[model samples]
Target: MSQKRVLITGAAGFLGSHLCDKFVSEGYFVIGMDNFITGDSKNIAHLTGNSNFRFIEHDVTNYINIEGDLDYILHFASPASPIDYLKIPIQTLKVGSLGTHNCLGLARSKGARMLIASTSEVYGDPLVHPQTEDYYGNVNTIGPRGVYDEAKRFQEAITMAYHRFHGLETRIVRIFNTYGPRMRLNDGRVIPAFMGQALRGEDLTVFGDGSQTRSFCYVSDQVDGIYKLLLSDYTNPINIGNPHEISIKDFAEEIIQLTGTDQKVIYQDLPIDDPMQRQPDITRAKDILGWEPKVGRAEGMKKTFEYFKSLTEEELYKSEHKDFTNYHK
Candidate 1:
């Protein structure tokens, strides 16, 4: 049989690039799409010469075009970080809405299975302790983070609609705090923010008195879970993330220890609508996909820090003192 083909939006992003690599390794013809709004070309540069890999420079918010037989489409295009979405709120909303619509249309035309990258943010400042797929989120629709939160909530909604109405094979993965290599150093996510500060010999910034919690899954495990979800017969949303939780204060200390930095952590008021407790109940993923994170925080952080340390002096120090006051990822 001929090799299968898959189109991955946000191809140069941290997670998307990794997904591209995964699909390519699985012997799929991969077509990666991105406009570089927040994605960096370097993330996907290694695949430049691969015969199975091709790239398209286009924004998914606009209409998408794919040639040849396409077996899968993973709609991951959007401003995933607080800084990116805050800077381009409209684009974030458009991609999650209009961009998703376009990808679904393309999937319909091509007779392909579709998967969307959803987020834990859908459960905005979640009232539930450990979020499950059935939990109706407690989101502030008009809040500052509403652009990304509502965008993802709508993404899931429309994806389900397409699955039901058009009979389009669809999967939704509600990703939690996933960290590994290729994460932009100053994206305002806690991992990169704290690590960047530690590398720069600066104090780690912990917003919200450091009590808010987060659970991080290593990138490779996240990719595996997504790969399994795409191939599984389940049609509803599934949470893919490490359930091991830690407070911001504790995570900051871990960074300091990992980097062997003398700088202390300073606390500030947490950003508005920031989830005080973020953890995923992955019972569905385990039951359906037999997926669980294999990388521990200690091992994953070491690998991640090694990658960050590989950066040049220019990347390490760029925006060294950028305000992390709003860092709540």
Candidate 2:
């Protein structure tokens, strides 16, 4: 059999870049497409010369026309960070709605199996802990964060429509908080936020009382689970994340220790609709995909710290002082 051809949208972003690398190493022809809206080209710069890897500057919200037989499509294009989505609300909605539509259509036309990257945010501010895939989320549609949350919800709905109505092979993996190398220092996710602050010897900002909890999954483990889901026949949404929970305050303290920063812990008002607690129940992922996160938080944090430490002072400063005012514009 010929080597499989895989198309990954948002191919320049954190998870997408890693996915491209994995496919290339596995001897698959990888087509990575991104608009550079939230993704940076530098993330995939190393792969520019690889034979099995190709990059396209395209936005998934627009129609896609590609040559050759596509064996699989991974629709992961969207502004995933809260700051990013809030900065470009319209773009967020479009990527989740129109972009997903285009990818599903392409999958149908090419007879390729597809997987949509959904999020644990689809659960909104969960009323349940250790959220199972079956739990209906408690989302606020009118809130500031609604654009991202609802867009993901709609993406899942339409993806399932294609699967049921069109009989297209489809998979959905609802990712929880994930962090590791390649995560933008200014992405505004908790891990990056804390790490950036500690690296700069600045006060660690903890939103709200810092009692809220979240589970963090290492990026490699997240990519591994995604690959498993894509190769499997599972049609339902599988929760992919580490179940080890930590309070926001403790997470901050851990970062301070790791960075050896004496920075103070500062409390800020929680952003609108921030999930108070998020921990995935990955029973389905384990039983079906036979996947579980292997990297412990301490080890993952050490690797991430090393990556951040390698940045130049200018790069480090930008990561630490990212402006959020124009995020939506």
Q: What is the C-alpha RMSD of each candidate to the true structure, in Å?
A: 3.4, 1.8
The TM-scores of all predictions, comma-separated, are 0.97, 0.97
After superposition of all CA atoms, the RMSD between model 1 and the true structure is 3.4
Tens digit of lDDT per residue, candidate 2, span 82-123?
A: 768877888899899999999999999999999999999999
Question: Top model by lDDT, which number?
Answer: 1
**What is the Å distance of residue 19 in model 2 from its true position?**
0.5
- Model 1 spans with C-alpha error above 4 angstroms: 320-329
| lDDT (10s digit) by residue, model 1, range 1-329 | 98999999999999999999999999999999998888889999999999999999998887888878999999888888898888777888989999999999999999999999999999888888899999999999999899999999999999999999999999999999999999998887999999899998988999988999999999999999999999999999999999999999999998999998899888888899999999999999999999999999999999999999999999998763333233222
Q: Where does the lowest 10-residue lDDT sum fall in candidate 2?
A: 320-329
TM-score, candidate number 1 = 0.97
User: Residue 140 of model 2: what lDDT?
Assistant: 99
lDDT of 2: 0.92
